[model samples]
Target: MRKIIIGVMGPGERAREDHVRNAFELGRLIAQEGWVTLTGGRNAGVMEAASLGAKEAGGLTLGILPTRDRNLISVAVDIPIITDMGSARNNINALTSDLIIACGLGTGTASEVALALKANTPVILLTENEEGKRFFKALKPKLVFIAKEPSEAIQMAKEILSP
Candidate 1:
């Protein structure tokens, strides 16, 4: 069977503590379930945190880098795709993963969420932003799910990925 890939999308530089913390737990849990954790693959913010969490849990991690800068790569990233596709790589992040969990909303994350929904990929939004929640939920009511916590998001992911 193919391994499930869980894309953890969030802010790279503007990620807050909650976003980082939740992304860590999400990555760890995803790894615990033998799923792959996919992220932007930078050494900062949510991407770094989630990758670290998955690596610590003995899970695989795939980094979809927007740039070719090897120095920007995260130490936790085992498989670096080195896209150099810039923001356009967001589409790859959204479409390639089996499911997407938006740990925190940002300009890039918003676009990724939309792309995922457009492709009918199940997305669980874990954000404290009411405006963002309202906006995304409005796009695809059936495909969008609002998660208040990382654990809850994982539970929802289970339901979505299960046969």
Candidate 2:
């Protein structure tokens, strides 16, 4: 089986309590589904939470970092792919992913979303509010699925990966 590369996009700071828990659950589910996780290599927020979850589940976690600094890499990341492309590397990361999960996000996350859309990779957004609804709606017919919880997001990703 071609390994399904799951991209997780979110901020670099510590996320809200709910988001942090959800991100961890999402990573666990992704590992359970036999998918590899790809994310930015940072120590806080959804990236760190998901990486840790995947690690605990015995899954491979790949970090696509913007610099060569080993100290900047997250502890949960098992493989670090260093690139000097800075923000431009976001597109490369998106291309490497077969599916993307967007948690609570920032500008960098937004860039990944755009790149995923451009690459025609399926994306699942985890958000419950009107803003998320509006954002998904605005991207009409792009195969961008939205879920209120981690399970739903993983389910959507699995469905997308089905042959």
Candidate 3:
């Protein structure tokens, strides 16, 4: 089976309690579905929450780190792909995925969403906020999908990947 690489994009800063819990649930759902997870290797917020969930579930968690230094990779990451591409690393990360899941995030996540859009990869935005809705609305039929919650996002991703 071709590994279903699910790109989990989100903010690196400290997240709210709800976002953290959701991230964990999202990661567990991805792992439970037997899909591979890809994310930026960082130690806080959504990245840490998701990676830890996936790892605990015995899922393959691939982390794409911006720095070439191995020590920069997050401890929760199972496989670290270190690159010196800086912000451009988002492009590589999106390219490695079959689907992209955008959690509540800031600038970095926005960049990943844009990269996924450019790549024509299916993106499932798990958000209910006006900003997220408006963002997708502006895209106007580019294959960007919206889901109100993690479960819906997971289901949408599965549907997109189904043969």
Candidate 4:
């Protein structure tokens, strides 16, 4: 059976405290459920936090890097796929994951969510950004869901991915 991959998307450098906390918990919970946690692979913000939690919880983590700089890769990343494609790597992140949980609102995260929606992939927006929620939901009513919390995001992932 293929392991489910849940991509954690959020701001890299300017991550909010809530976003970091939520991403960590989400990664931990995702690990507990025996799922793979995927992130941007950077050593900052949600990518680092989520990978750290997942790695600590004994989960497999895959990081899709937007840069060729190996030093930027998260220490917790078990597998890092270096992509020199820059922000365009968001396409890979959005398309590769079985599900995506947007941990916060950011330009990068928004693009990932949009790419996911465009591909008809399921996304759970785990942010309090009402405007973002409204915009995304307006784009894909069924494919886009909102979760106010990390645990709820996990539950929504299950509901979205289950056969």
Ranking by lDDT: 1, 4, 2, 3
Candidate 4, 1-163: lDDT as tens digits: 9899999999988999999999999899999999999999999999999999998899999999998999999999999999899999999999999989998879999999999988988999988899999999998999999988888888888888889
Model 4 spans with C-alpha error above 4 angstroms:
none
lDDT of 1 at 107: 93
- Clash count of each predicted structure: 0, 0, 0, 0
lDDT of 2 by residue, 40-66 (tens): 877778888889989889899998888
In model 3, the runs with Cα more than 4 Å from the true position are 140-142
Cα lDDT of model 3 by residue, 1-163, tens digit? 5878888888777566666677778888899999888889877778878898888888889888887877667798988888878888999978998988888757788788878888888888875457765776578466788888888889888888888
As for model 2, its CA RMSD to the true structure in angstroms is 1.5
Off by over 4 Å in 1: none
- Please report how far candidate 2 places residue 18 from its true position, in Å: 2.1
In model 1, what are the clashing residue pairs, if there are any?
Answer: none
TM-score of 1: 0.98
Tens digits of lDDT, candidate 1, 38-70: 999999899999999999899999999999999
lDDT of each: 0.93, 0.82, 0.81, 0.93
Off by over 4 Å in 2: none
Question: What is the lDDT for 111 in model 3?
Answer: 81
Error of 3 at 38 (Å): 0.5
Instruction: Choose 2 or 4, whichever is better by lDDT.
Output: 4
